[model samples]
Target chain A: MRETPSLIVRYVARRAVPFIQLYALYVLGHGEDGPGGGFQGGVIFASSFVLLALAYGWGQGRKHVPEKLFDLLAPAGCLLYAGIGFVALLVGGAFLQYEAFVGEGADHATKHHAHHFGLIGIELGVMLTVTASMVILFFEMSRPDEEGAFGDGASQEDVEALHDGSAATEEAPDA
Target chain B: MEVLILAILVGLAVAAVRARDLMASVAILGGYSLMMALLWCQMNALDVGFTEAAVGAGISTVLMLAALGRIGRREVGPTRAPLLRLPLLTMQQRLRRARHLSRQHHRSSAWGAILVCVLVGGALLYGTRDIPQVGASDSPANRAGSLAEYYVTKAPEEVGPANMVTSVLGDYRGYDTMGETVVIFTAALCVLMLLRQARVRRGDERDA
Candidate 1:
């Protein structure tokens, strides 16, 4: 009935999760300069949460990062993205046309300011959407079934015991 | 050269369809898409090639894997010719009718008809002498006053991003990208809603 994972395994998982999230952020931030982008980076970042849930159990991860928060943030991110484009439209240019944001002056400084503002806004929107979606997906996938309702909000120890029991059954039959 | 490329494309497509293993078929499809992307690049359609790379190779492969995970991996049986049972007709009459048909006609009557049509269509394409040569600088895509010129010249200055295509897609065509994102969001929401177990309301308790 021993449920807890070994100290070594727990230690490794705890350390690894933060690094994975950081890497995802790096990928998202540098997406324009590199091969990676919002979609790929978001998936990778979300996977870190999935890994955390797998290793430490879903309850702990959910306690740390709630699904409801991501649910709200996901749409908010989309709205933020759309809002930027709407701003451009209101400025007398076509939707998302940055030239309209620039003042009446024909100089490069005006153009550069508009371009910088537009790119930053779009990147922020992408980052928000990607992070929220990934976390939400992981939560949905790892939610407990009715049969395991007894183990709902179960600790990491309980999950380890279940995993070990299944592993033992498979190994015992072969041996 | 174009003929050789077309022949290879045909062979790859056939292999993708006929492969017995689902994983193998998926791999073949990936190869087919990669080849098609390369062909696009060679034809000087870089934008199309970029899109094919992103959607065909990246998204499609992930989707296929996700689907395979949900479905069982093993192939059930060797793919047989679809059974065509004429319930009212006698077996003898069916045999007689099948024998009376020519082999070419029989083959063309089945799914292979589509293949034959495609091959004939390709042959007909060879007769279009007025068609511009591939990657011709004077082609409409490269002609004066074309959109490509504007994209090449103004995109970097206007968007402040070195990647002109990304700028055009994310900024210049932001509305379209926003719509596409909404479509993706809707699809994701639909999948989540359909697959999710119905929630039990408070006070509606039943012991398992």
Candidate 2:
């Protein structure tokens, strides 16, 4: 079996994923003030995962970030978003009306607090959904079948062994 | 200034369509979309601009690249010579000879291009007719109760979000936004399904 790529590439990608994820969070959090938003930030963050998959291998990438989790999280994020609106409706306000959540507060501070809560909840949901969707898309696109399996253009059997090895590890006894 | 921008947009669009290379065409199309987005921003259609920037500049380019990956990159050479010419042909001659031959070889492609251009141009013209006057304060959007005012003034306070557009999309008109999200999800699901690996049976049918 041939060796993987340089440790430097893996190390760089490993280091970069966190920073990229952090930037995505910043973009999502500050979307109201900046050009970057949930969608763009999500794709940018997902690019790191694609880079990681390229640097390492798909099996390792999938092990690190499972496809099933992404599939679940994508819809879950949207559900959380809609659930917020449902909460607003339950509060006797119109659909998605945050004002009802504010109550009859006298002070401006109280009103601002309520508003922040609602916005944060929604933005977080958007970020989760967008990021998951993008990562899933990358996975779907770059996934190897019979042709073009490894990063170094390796044989299909090697890729299959790698995949099966990862699957076996996933099913292994806990330490 | 508007005319200059429009001219640039038209030129970029022509270049996008006329480019021989698929990747070059896709890149030019992205530029054309971005220019059109800038024009939308200049026109104060911020929502439209946002949608166009995201869908046109981003998603469309990505989709085109994915398509290029599936389809080989090599461009087909142009045909050798022009085939047909009709100076004062009768309807029967036109239908039987010109139209039928065109449908088989080349004429349909040109006709399809012309038809698409005409349809798109007509739609743009029709939409422009109904659009509110540029920078008019009394436009329908402006007069729609306190929505615009809320976006300007109370947006930050109400949503605790500095970006009014984000607040509006994620909170105020969230239902419509949810629908848009669903549309994206559906599209993604469809693409995934269509492209998913198909299982080949052991005793499959005979080869063609």
Overall local distance difference test of candidate 2: 0.67
lDDT of 2 by residue, B6-75 (tens): 9998888877665555666889888888888899888876656765776577656765654654453335
Kindly list the per-residue Cα lDDT of model 1 for residues A1-175, writing each as its tens digit.
1243667877888899889879777765665554444554565576676566656765766776775677777777678878888888898877776767875675887786787677667656765676666566545544554544313333453455456446544544442
Q: How would you encode candidate 1's per-residue C-alpha lDDT over B1-208 as one tens digit per residue?
A: 6567778889988776755455556777777787787777777666566546655764465456445434423345533221222354578866766655544355546658888888889888876766777657798887878888788888777667666756766766777767765664565565467545344432245533
> iRMSD (Å) of candidate 2?
8.0
Docking verdict class for candidate 1: incorrect
Instruction: Estimate the TM-score of every prediction.
Output: 0.62, 0.68
Residue pairs clashing in model 1 are: none
Q: In TM-score terms, which candidate is top?
A: 2
* Stretch of 10 with least lDDT, candidate 1 chain A: A148-157
Interface RMSD of 1: 7.2
RMSD to truth, every model = 10.0, 12.4
